[model samples]
Target chain A: MSVKLTEDMLKALPDSRGHFGAFGGRFVSETLMDSLMTLEREYLRLKEDPEFQATFDKDLADYVGRPSPLYFAERLTREAGGAQIWLKREDLNHTGAHKVNNTIGQALLASFLGKKRVIAETGAGQHGVATATVCARLGLECHVFMGSEDVKRQSLNVYRMKLLGATVHSVESGTKTLKDAMNDAMRDWVANVDDTFYIIGTVAGPHPYPLLVRDFQSVIGRELREQSVAQAGRLPDALVACVGGGSNAIGMFYPFLGDESVQLYGVEAGGLGIDSGQHAAPLCAGRPGVLHGNRTYLMEDENGQIAGTHSVSAGLDYPGVGPEHAWLKDIGRANYVSVTDEEALDGFRKLTRIEGIMPALESAHAVAYGLKLAATMDKDQVLVINVSGRGDKDIHTIAQLDGIEI
Target chain B: MSRIEGVLKALKSQGRKALIPFVTAGDPHPDETVALMHALVAAGSDIIELGVPFSDPMADGPVIQLACERALKHGTSLRRVIAMVKEFRETDTETPVVLMGYLNPMEAMGYETFADAAADAGIDGILTVDLPPEEADEVAPLFAARNLDPIFLLAPTTTDERIRAISEHSSGYVYYVSIKGVTGSASIDVDEVARKVAHVHELTALPVGVGFGIRDAETAAAVGRVSDGVIVGSVLVDTIARHQTDPKALHQALTDLLNPMRKALDSLAQ
Candidate 1:
């Protein structure tokens, strides 16, 4: 079922209507259509202009601390005892995740559009912090919607958002998680469409959003391309990144879509286990359905009602994935796998002790999968795992597991 | 002609606007919905808009979102909603029943399966909130093949060009959202809705129904004067939320709330 991607596949996607082969389109209401069209028009024009590209590059380099390092984990590679393991150090970014790469681009777009207010939704609060950081820099009023459950789980990040001058709204709606927070953010955007720009954190949501977010976040893959050639003399044999709403993974995978020699893997949060039915691996075990403005693979019940998802890592506790990932999965362009919570926790501690680097629980999923893949490969082969965020935010979660008071 | 067209044409001939009342299929209780459909038809409604409950109603406000939750707690799947419409059909088949909600539940049932099931269940029209014309091609053909009128929404912000596009895909009528917000919002400017409805009229010959903020008899009357239909949803769901415990009170509250709006709309004919 795996069809080889043509070279033009990289530039030809989404078509004129934002569909990544029946996976995406604007499935929003009539009210949002006009604003989305205006956004699409503006984006199309700005995407072609050299000045806008220059401005984006300037912000990414100066404000976002871009060209994040690609480092070789010698100790971890020796421990794995098979393939040489490398890491993309997105954790050292300004906001501690790859989320800022997209946020800075969107905030620039918001400024160009003259939208003075911004709204965002978050689960692990990385996206919220990233959005608030950029909004504060641009002097834009920022409002963030977070599920009430997440408000308790990630309270430190919530406080950080507050300190950044963003008003955090606890969304007590369906499942009390990322999906509901997204629903509330859409509601806020619909109501205040005139002056408010919605900064969707992931490569999800409606038309221009999935396309634009991927374009902004694609800096990861573009940078990795050059950095690999410089540091390792070639692209790694395999690339791995964790998939929540799939922003980080897609960011790192977009530029390599046509690199057929390089294998791409997206790791999903497997919670207890896939067989236990307590996981958030939608691409592995979901059907096609429409939710949150895009038709993608979703964890839904037989009635088409979205199912509640469980993941130890809050970032991957989502029902649906990005549409581009869905298209890739269908076409066999990329492989998706899941690691159980126990495996992820082990991965978290292993990298910390072996490499003196603690990865966020979300990134630990990729680390867990990458280690297993590395063990099966030849020692000459290379593997790069995205250390998507720092583990400083996950200390409490890890501490509670060990029965230690923080 | 489709039942929706017959009803609207008959109303146009009589010089009366459509008083379309929207209610969730299993709100209050699953047992109460069929009878509630009867009550809405009896309360001078021209068409009945039955809401299919979804787990996440992104387009709705607090009122309808809570209503969807209440309905889902009873396990009101799309099949159950279709069965409810079938039950309503047994008593009175003249009143056109239009199922309204987001697209996921119907997509879950498969477009072909859902269209066939709905047609067999005596459904007349469908208004999937999230499925706009650009995304409606696959399902719209299936619905049309099944003789179901594929309804579409036209917002205040829709351009003239897009209005023509939506009109080409829509059959029953164009639902015009009176406000830029979700359902159950407060206060729509009557004159603004009047202007937008007029703009839609210039592009499509289909009947226009305004909804999203029509709460009281006064707003209904004011909106009825400008468009062919007035859709009231959140206020009725709000009534169900308030008096759901007492069946007798629920019936009375619905009648009391709807009768005034019905009478006011009828007065527009004069």
Candidate 2:
């Protein structure tokens, strides 16, 4: 059921207490209940105000580089032969990945709430580094929480966060990975509610966060609205982005949710393959359960414990997604598909060699899906690809597979 | 009215407090859980909240976590817990037994099926740790339609609006968590408990039960002086954790732990 997007009415609702069609609500411990409630109230007030939007927009334009161009890939299109492919360069944002957009907005909101210390959890280390960079620039005390496994894998990003003047703490709980790191970060925010703000990476978490992060990341969609019309004289035939915790996909898909004609494709990472029992394809091989305060399709065991997940890209290793994606998948508004690790590496190489643009491993997953779909569609058909982040961080991960040095 | 209702109401009539004890079912063994529940009621429990073991219990502290681990090791489940309640129902039907746990098993079994089974087993209510009042719209009605009370919780930091929301949805009574923490903690906030109880009383006439950190008789009596019920958990779970293999020692340990809080509540009752 696609509801007509009334900008005024929909903006007013905003998951009143984060109930996105029974997917999002506050399901936390007693200690977090109060802090989350307080933040929820404040965030709603700020998001509804026009001045906050103006300030956010101005910062996005002048500071974070908004209105990121839609560059059509002519050579790549001929090679694929189906549809004309366009890239929305969010990777060109100040901090490599699309993470900075939301982090900058949340850090400001944190400061607005009179919070001094910022705590964050990172999986791919992009979010942690971005949060540390923004917090350092904003003069806030920053503490980054990393899963021990992620710290071992993404040690360079860990060092980058520390170099940005943030204290990085390795969390050793649950799976000793992203989800566990998020839990520990939440524990800290709960314990130190008076002075801390949790700079969540994705459009996941309890009330206001899913809404807040989406609002901040909406710059991707809003800019696409103006840029796409200017370039193609109309909206693209489809909007495609990778979905992990689903920040970038949401950032690209939401503004087009009301546009019935635009096909939306969310590419999930098929690490080895769907049959491997390790891929983080929740929509394809999962059930609805409550995790991280939202009821969504989660990679859960028979006992409902958070099971381990795998994806070659560190950013795409999460088991559950933002609750909004769950609702979208249920309603059939967006098509959630998958691409194998081998296909993603091929896309990463193709984009680099052909378009001269190095794409993030997370973004390469989307490019890989486009490569297959574009070959089958008409030449006049337009496809908008959200280049989520730059591929500099993934050079190491890619090197292990095959050398991309030259 | 049921015997447990009559007993609690009569105690309340005298301006007495309700001493509600929480014991994990089948901790160490099922038979010991039965003995412990009976002893606690005899010793002076106005109501009983039996914790159904789950694998990933997020809100629980170390003591309760250990209790759940032990119970799971011995093959305890929601099915076995209901069976234990049915056995208890044949003897004493008055003492209200509320099954407190997470929402998955109940949701997995289907709400109506679980409600029917619980009502048939003589369960008075349920308190799912993860299901908040907002999401309990469908769930609370499931129990209420089956004549089973859906007990809700009000935390120390719950706002006036949330307190009203929870109060409006509650059935049997409201569980007022004493501290701003999980179950089994070192300190009890007596002031916050009184404040929350008063806050809930303003919105609804439901009895308020305080839990999470009441360790001894003094804390129980103090909380009882202000609230309608005093719930003691971790300490009882700790009792089972200490006597893992010895059932007699576990029973004795449970009895010893209950006697003091029971004595304190009994004094308030008289």
Candidate 3:
């Protein structure tokens, strides 16, 4: 059931410690040389230090509400015509999204470094809300860069962030959206690397981020495994998670990467269809290129400028994914697949109507896969998935699009 | 052959380094754009990287970003940068002029069309920061058709495998970043830079010109001692922006930075 590759197996590489299976490596500008070196030193110490994990573990439990529930979705499983399905409800956590888990860990770590301000950029507003929530709790000065378009679409989220006491900047340049927001955040980081901590939300940035964000989000997999093994009396047959910058997917997949029996599937948003220009499935359609912080699969133009992307879920409406996932797709370690906007919309309706659960549109991609894959499998097979966030934030857009069609 | 190969050819025969100077087109004012190019070549710049201003530059640091913002505010576009290149090429055809910029405007104008315009405008090379070597086919094929050098960045963090990868497809000299972060920070470890430059040299005879954190004339001198070229960015921009209202201070600072490094590289051959 495991796909374990010993650390000694990877020792031949120059950056064995940095690479994960075939993923993760430093790809950044020279300005961050000393800073990255400093971080590498600090992270190396923290990796081996029990006290550091102990502190993080305490924050996960006491502060962020850890060990999120894994509940059986009996009705939805029956409707999908497959084995019993279970959901690791990360949405039920504080901030109504799994992003809180990473935010709390990073904000705490920022405090450990005596950093006074925490800065970030958000696309869908979930990460911004989570970061702002943590900053409010920790009393750190929080500045969030949001795209002007995102501010308009996710008005509730924008207001929520402002209510949480974050200084929100609406970026007006470069498509006025997530990628632009990220550029603004990077600019801010470049200017304030001295006293501020850049709390990146996803696993997409240069080296340490893909690694760190995964480590922070791995609690979902860890808890799901512990609870499922205890109740189901065995590990689940497969682990499924949605990929947006691939952070949540990496989190859930990291704890189970060695478990070969636990097949992993990363579902991407196929906005109209893979053939349509509107999709956000970078791994499926995009070629390898550098974006944000590192080289990865990105939706780029002939001139390599990041092109516009579309998804039913604002969060998954990105042009690139983390490089680790890029490597994972290459190695065929984890299958990267897509769920069309229509398919995800159906999943959204099924979860709400059958299981009495409303999933964030981003999470609906995984749910869409669950429904499709369930029909092909035997009834005895069990599947576990991450219900990454709640649907409250997505309702306005869904309403605007008018409930699921076909 | 790439224009960079010509510079490397000269360096090999003359036993000299490529002194590359980057100046923003339409910076301070649109008229100064071509004038600065002529002044830089006269000041001993072996290659001139003329930056085309983009509204959003995620990869640039504060200094270059600000320079770009100022350039953009003045309506500096690819067309204007090409015009500057054409004007400069009239007087200085030997010195290579590389148009360094983000990818949006190029795509906005269409790559094939942009390449033709650039070639007609006498531009020799282009360096798009966002376009990694892995995806050079995005625009490189078109640029190659027009005989334009496609410059790429290889940072200190780039592995030997990556350097080989970058060098295989990269035309022009590799823009070797001496540090790990953004554009302008402070004091670099020259010993570490020497080690990284040696590593970069192993992959390609394509002259590796080091940039980022080489801010002062002293630091430029230090870099010129080890590498084929030294790129001074923030210090130059700061000097220019400091006396935006007065051109004399800008000239004074430019002379201050380029003179000592010119002397150091001159002494290197002796």
Candidate 4:
């Protein structure tokens, strides 16, 4: 499953069978084969249709508040003292995260498929809120599976989901985290495959999911490309985004793949540190294996059991990454790194204090790494970090860490 | 012929539907697995489908998930499960053993190495729940090279064309999942399974073994009348969960649960 693809093949990848050089094929049970095939077929047709594209574009403008600003972080740039740091303001999106981009697109696909019910697996509740928001708008029944641990930590988001009229199922299975939530959602989708549309929260899962999610979320990079040229007269020197299941990072990285000059970096959560063997950095420290549905880098024990991962951010607490990121890392197209929990918290604080903009803890990982990378560069060079979500949902976690009553 | 083929053939000739019992390896304790295997054979199980516990069994319900956790708690690994099979093979070589689980463990071992080790440890067949026919194209030949029957599953949603495709790749009996959901989910519609099993028989000569939702002797007997074999799980694992404290009660309870199903399957003999 660890085969490598040449540079040219990476451009037209996933082939026909969804293999990104031995990753991202359909590994689901036989029951799901037909539904997935149908989804792939419909997605292929709709992605090319003019009307579908127009509606999606309109929804981005009218509903999701698209073209989220690409702002120059003047203060952070001055603080870094080496590079001109810019922030892709995905945090300003309607649902307060880049997750809405993919959810709205998938919700439209679900409606196109005539599916009345939608199911989604969420880790930090951001995706759940985003998905529920779309389902409410589309008049579809929504079910969101969340790990029990995350449900407790992200209780505010859980209430937000309920207020949006989505049923939240607290998954108590496995480690009670993101991977188990995905497992439970898969089971639910299998049982109700006829009526349910599984809106995967990331750029992971089986073939069409990674492919479709990437296509939907690629708006981030597409917009950033135009925004970069308009703001700085050229593409930025580098692009940085945090990778939980690699959705936002891949979204920000896809359109820039052909731009040979713009370097890309993906930041994975380093709970303690990579050397501590407790982080969720699969690309850095793990091996290639099948989990969920695609063959990607996974954090597994010697016996192939999925290992438990630790990250202060629930969204980044997954065992496997998107297969495309795995391909990107293997082919030397992009760089993958990890930032420790302490560093991410520091990034969270620095961004809020210096820039007056709070970032989701997941995005703070990229901010944290970007700060280090910026400091090592010349002041004339430019770097852009994707602030993928607002940190309002993380206030409880931050307060608890600081031992504050709030 | 492979051991799985031989057993299914003998059962077919005798007009007796195969009664396949499934148990997770090292459940309760690793030391007790071999004894449980022997007890299952003594209770007239035709073939033993031993589950290799996985951390994330997305296809299984709570019963099997808890069973996997129990097995893993005792440090059960793929090699350990294979070693347990070798121990079972020491005395009883006739009853075929089929290793069943998710693909990652076998994949971690590498297909060639896993195939070699499994064949050496007396494994006759492999049923990776997550490896559909599309993805099995790579690993099927590796298992085939080692004469390990690569078993595939047929879901209710599987079309006739797919049934042919899956049958072409499968060497041993193709398991027909009786329901649409995970293991231990919803009751099986006997008539619906009979129709699907009959459809499968028309497409391929591979024996159809019905599983998932088979709980009692009556359900086993109903399903046995249509398919060539009946695979029982979850209920037996639930029993093990109940009697986990006492080995004697565990053995007795296993035998007690399997004995009636065995008799029910045998009663269908012409």
- Worst 10-residue lDDT window for candidate 1 chain A reads A1-10
Q: Each candidate's fnat, in order?
A: 0.89, 0.18, 0.21, 0.77
lDDT of 1 by residue, B1-270 (tens): 999999999999999999999999899888889999998888888899999999989889999999999999999999999999999999898999999989999988998999999999999999999988888879978988988999999887888899999998999898999998989976899999998898889899999999989999999999999999999999999999999899888888889999999999999998
Model 3 DockQ class: incorrect
lDDT for each residue of candidate 2 in B90-145, tens digit (9 for 90 to 100) = 88877889999887667656678889999899898888887787667777777777
Best by TM-score: 1
Better of 2 and 4 by DockQ: 4
Q: lDDT (0-100) at residue A141 of candidate 3?
A: 99
User: Model 3, B100-211: lDDT tens per residue?
Assistant: 8876567667778889999998888888876665435558788888889888888755667768877888777889877655678556899999988987887787888898
Error of 4 at B87 (Å): 0.5
Candidate 2: where are CA atoms >4 Å away? A1-17, A26-41, A48-50, A167-169, A301-306, A352-358, A395-406, B2-4, B13-16, B23-46, B53-58, B62-84, B87-94, B195-204, B238-249, B267-270
A best-first ranking of the candidates according to their lDDT comes to: 4, 1, 2, 3
Clash number for candidate 1: 0
Residue A334 in model 3: lDDT: 84
TM-score of candidate 1 versus the correct structure, residues matched by position: 0.99
Candidate 2 CAPRI classification by DockQ: acceptable
Q: Give chain B TM-scores in order.
A: 0.99, 0.94, 0.95, 0.98
Residue A26 in candidate 4, Cα distance off native in Å = 1.1
Could you give candidate 1's per-residue lDDT for residues A1-406 as a string of tens digits? Answer: 6777787866778888999997988999989999998999999999999989999999889988988999999999888888889999999999899999999989989999999999999999999999999999999999999999899889889999999999999999999999999999999988999999999999999998999999999999999999988988888889999999999999999888988889999999999998888999999989899999999999999999999999999999999999999999999989999999999999999999999999999999999999999999989898999999998888989999999997
Question: lDDT values of the candidates?
Answer: 0.93, 0.82, 0.79, 0.93
What's the TM-score of every candidate structure? 0.99, 0.87, 0.71, 0.98
Native interface contacts retained, candidate 3: 0.21
Q: Give DockQ per model, in order.
A: 0.90, 0.27, 0.17, 0.86
TM-score: model 4 vs. ground truth? 0.98
